[model samples]
Target: MAWVYLIIAGIFEIGWAIALKYTEGFSRPWPTVFFGVSMTLSVWMLALALKTIPVGTGYAIWTGIGAAGTAILGMILFGESHDGWRLFSIALIVIGIVALKISSS
Candidate 1:
């Protein structure tokens, strides 16, 4: 289903984002390759998802998932800070994504 594809795309988005952290501004060859492949897959899957899902809703969901997942990963793995404001903002993004899905239905 399109939603499944969207979720997969979101996962790939997470992959690309995390890989980007390891790429060191593309100075590391293997990590940079990983980043490139992950980014390509993410966008490809997102395009596939748009085949069936409404573009606006699908894009919102995809971006929300990417941003939230990447932020959480950054906090946990990359020594990024997680403050109250960050948590609140992520929660708001999640709520908005959910609202979009609901409204689309």
Candidate 2:
């Protein structure tokens, strides 16, 4: 289904985002390659999902997944932050994503 592709694409977006951080400004070979590949796949999947889903709603949900996942992973894996406000903001993004999905259906 299109929703499945969208979710997978969003997860790949998180992967590419983290891989980009490891790329060291494209200086590193493997991480850079990973980022490139992941980014391509993510975009490809997003486009595929867009064939069925409304652009505005689908894109918003995709970004919401990527942003929230990236922030949470940054805190857990990269040492970005554990701030309450940051967590709250991520929660809000999640809530918004859910609301959008519910409204779309």
Candidate 3:
């Protein structure tokens, strides 16, 4: 349950991050609203997960997911770099996230 919340929070963290690009410095109303909502949900879910999960472990995993996910989306959606090294770096972050989850369990 707590893991589920944490995963959802991580996803919302990605959502808010991507939406931020569309927000154009908060000048775009719709994207700004989406960013706000997703950010709120992400934080709320993180709070729920933190009720059980250790703060350091949970926060690291959450940010790891966000960072890796947002990077992938940036490449796919915004024509950002898809270099081998960049991909490898994202994979390492994913590996770290998996390791943290396994260690926590």
In order, the Cα lDDT scores of the candidates are 0.91, 0.96, 0.99
For model 3, residues 1-105, the per-residue Cα lDDT tens digits are 999999999999999999999999999999999999999999999999999999999999999999999999999999999999999999999999999999999
Number of the top candidate by TM-score? 3
TM-score of each: 0.94, 0.98, 0.99
Summarize candidate 1's per-residue lDDT along 31-103 as a digit string, tens digits: 8998889889889999998998899899999999999999999999988989999999999998998898889
Cα lDDT tens digits, model 2, 19-91, are: 9999999999999999999999999999999999999999999999999999999999989988999999999
What is the RMSD of candidate 3?
Answer: 0.4
Instruction: Indicate the residue-level lDDT of 34 in model 1.
Output: 87
Over 4 Å off, model 3:
none
Model 1 clash pairs are none
**Among all candidates shown, the one with the greatest lDDT:** 3
Number of clashing residue pairs, candidate 1 = 0
| Clashing residue pairs for model 2 | none
TM-score of 2: 0.98
For model 1, the run of ten residues with the poorest summed lDDT: 96-105
